[model samples]
Target: MAVRVDLNLSLDGIAMPANQTAENPMGEDWGRLVAAYVGTKTMRERVLRDTTGEGTTGVDDRYAAAYFDGVGAEIMGAAMFGLHSFPDDPDWRGWWGEEPPFGYPVLVLTHQQRRTIDFANGTRFEFLSVSPQEALDQALRLAGGADVRIGGGVGTVRDFLTAGLVDRLHVAVSPIVLGQGTSLWDDLRSFDLGYAVTSELSEAGVNHVTFAR
Candidate 1:
């Protein structure tokens, strides 16, 4: 099983946009960063649960479809799970709705202890207070030989990338420049030396870049 990561970055390589608040947990420029991905048919139907038959069905949609292709389990950071936004609230489920798109086990890396939450759609949120490798071990077991995804908000992805645990890295480079934010390539100098890389530009101006080992 492979460990994969899919992220949206700006032209400046800002994966996590700045100006974050409780009202907008994803940050102010988040929409612009992921505009192309969210506009795809697969994202509309899958994540948004929109069945209107709308949304683009081009190259961006294909990548969006592949985002959920073989992911058996997910490991994400606290921010990705909305813990940083709603830490005090005991009832805060997550940014995802009642039936999250993930129909598999998901591990949230957070220090704040919480009980495991199971959804009816086979999606289980198990909070973990462990290292990146430890979390990956648990996710691998839960994956049952299927591919494990390193879903991120920034820090989590960097941890896995720094540890050289990721097998596939795909980033949708949106044509926007956010002056301030955490970049995906921060401290990752010469990170592409070992991987075979390819790039394709979508109709929506998103450059889909993939680094595969």
Candidate 2:
């Protein structure tokens, strides 16, 4: 099974915005960075659970549709799971509501251990404090031979990449530039050493880049 990473970032490689606060968790810059991806019909149908069929179609939607294909399990950092925003709030399930888009197991990498949360549509969240390899091992078991996705907020993806655990990485680079924020490529110099790079510009003005090893 392939270890994949699909993410959207600013032109400057910023995965998270600098002005993030409790008032604006995603921050103002997040919208611009992920506009193309969120505007797709696939995202609308899956993440938003919108059955209205009222979103963009074509290249962007194609990539958005491929995001969830064959992904049996997901591994994400605590921040991505909304733990950073509500550290003490035990009731905070995640950014996704009752029925999360991921219809599989989710391993939340966090220092603070919590009981496993099972949601509707077979989405299970298991908080764990383990190394990247260990986390992947658990995810693989939960994946049932399907691919393990490295869902991210920058730090987690970088950790897996540094550990040489990722096999396929797809990055959608938006046109906007967030001058300061969490960067995905900070310590990832020569990260594409063993991967073959491919790029394509979509109609939404986002660059669809993929690194496959």
Segments of candidate 2 deviating more than 4 angstroms:
none
Which residues of candidate 1, in runs, are more than 4 Å off?
A: none
- lDDT per residue for candidate 1 within 138-174, as digits (tens), equals 9999999999999997899999999999999999998
Q: Model 2, 1-213: lDDT tens per residue?
A: 899999888889988888888988978788888888889999999888889998999889999999989999999999999999999999889998999989899999999979899987999999999999999999999999999999987889999999999999999998898998888899889998889999999998899999998
Count of residue pairs whose backbone atoms collide, per candidate: 0, 0
Per-residue lDDT value at 172 in model 1: 93
Give the Å shift of residue 65 in candidate 1: 0.2
Q: lDDT for every model?
A: 0.93, 0.92
> Which pairs in model 1 have colliding backbones?
none
